[model samples]
Target: MGEQHGCQTCHGDTDAHVADPTMKNVLVYQAKGGSAVDELSAKCLACHDSDTHMAMWKMSKHSRNDISCFNCHTMHATRGAVDQPTKCFTCHRDIKVAVNKQSHHPIIENKIKCSDCHNTHGTATQHMIKDDTVNQLCYQCHAEKRGPFVWEHSPVEENCLICHSPHGSRHAKLLVEKVPNVCQDCHDWSRHPGTPYDANAGFTGSSPSNRFFARSCLNCHGAIHGSANFENHGLRQ
Candidate 1:
């Protein structure tokens, strides 16, 4: 780890630069259309290839896209700059907006980081998520939703993305769609569920309040996720 294997290891043989003080003699990591991305990345992987977090770097989207470590990291910077999310937000502007939505994970608050759910170096899972499955990643924080209920909701069991948007959504509870509408996607729209409810239907209280007037389907079917009640198969409990 002396000068022979230190900065010169990546900077290339710099004896000529030290002797003559010429920029052309030293190897620069920047993308100047001179060196291929692989050539530049190889210098970084020389040391990082053995690190546990970097084991899957070759399979990562960044690597596939020709993004070198130098793109996001500055060798001269202090430790604080190396781990900050600000550099990430420069390229992931959309995620920055999504994280600021009314309902979102605590990324801005620093309680949760992008790395908490994602392996930037790469993973077998799509989106580079840390867990094998999306639901498994979510289960880390929402343990209550990881239940084996007596009567399980098909969407909840299959995938959380079926009803919720993982990033952010304007709808309440990060729902992909509004309450009754979201429920109606799979429910048979034959009777009460399909009926349109307007103020005119119950303005004078002559008719029972429509689904839209109250808390929608959830008013009665409180246990939408699942129901443990022995007699309440409809999730009324």
Candidate 2:
């Protein structure tokens, strides 16, 4: 069948010819056992060696774990467009469940794909992110949040993951925790180094717990991350 169907006809060429000899190292593969499965996989890797993104796959966790290129992608288009978490979920079911929860990065709704945020090929970072910094990667989509404002929340500028789960979140607004506690994380009343506040009485009276915590604190304190207003009092901006 190799001659009848012409392996070269379907697979293009299998000979070793290089456009750039310097990239010779990219053709590395394991076919030691030399079975049909191993040989076929090695054949697929031949042409893929020319792709720069695939070159980085060698250093990835998935590569180390024996995940091959065909695991998530369909070069031949047999499995349709290969829906995002659907492909990823095939291996990571638990994470898929979490990613399908209440709030997330829109991957579930197909607004974005996992490959948009992650490099299936290897990266300097463990998660295979395309960039060196996590926040920098997130800023590609949330450009509005990327700012050098006079008042900056350290975590917002640092890593969005500190407060949000990039894949999915159970809480509203993609927060790791609910509002008041989420704000209280770094901005505890005691730790407000700018202008101190009274935490002695935790909202008593008939005021609803959720309303008091959510609005009262954030409303008066217009800018949770310290305002630039020169005339501002404590938090009454």
Report the number of the highest-TM-score candidate: 1
Best prediction by lDDT: 1
**In order, what lDDT does every prediction score?**
0.74, 0.63
lDDT (Cα, tens digit) per residue for candidate 1, span 1-237? 333466687787788778887556456877783667887788777777665546778888988998888888776677675445677787888988887888877777888788888887788779999998989998999888877777777788888899998877778888988877787777644533434555566544323344433335675677766767745644564
Tens digits of per-residue lDDT for model 2 on 34-116?
23433444566655565655666666787777666656665446765766778888887876877788987777777887778
Question: Model 1: C-alpha RMSD to truth?
Answer: 4.1
Q: What TM-score would every model get versus the actual structure?
A: 0.82, 0.68
What residue pairs clash in candidate 2, if any at all?
none
Error of 1 at 128 (Å): 0.2
lDDT agreement of model 2 with the native? 0.63
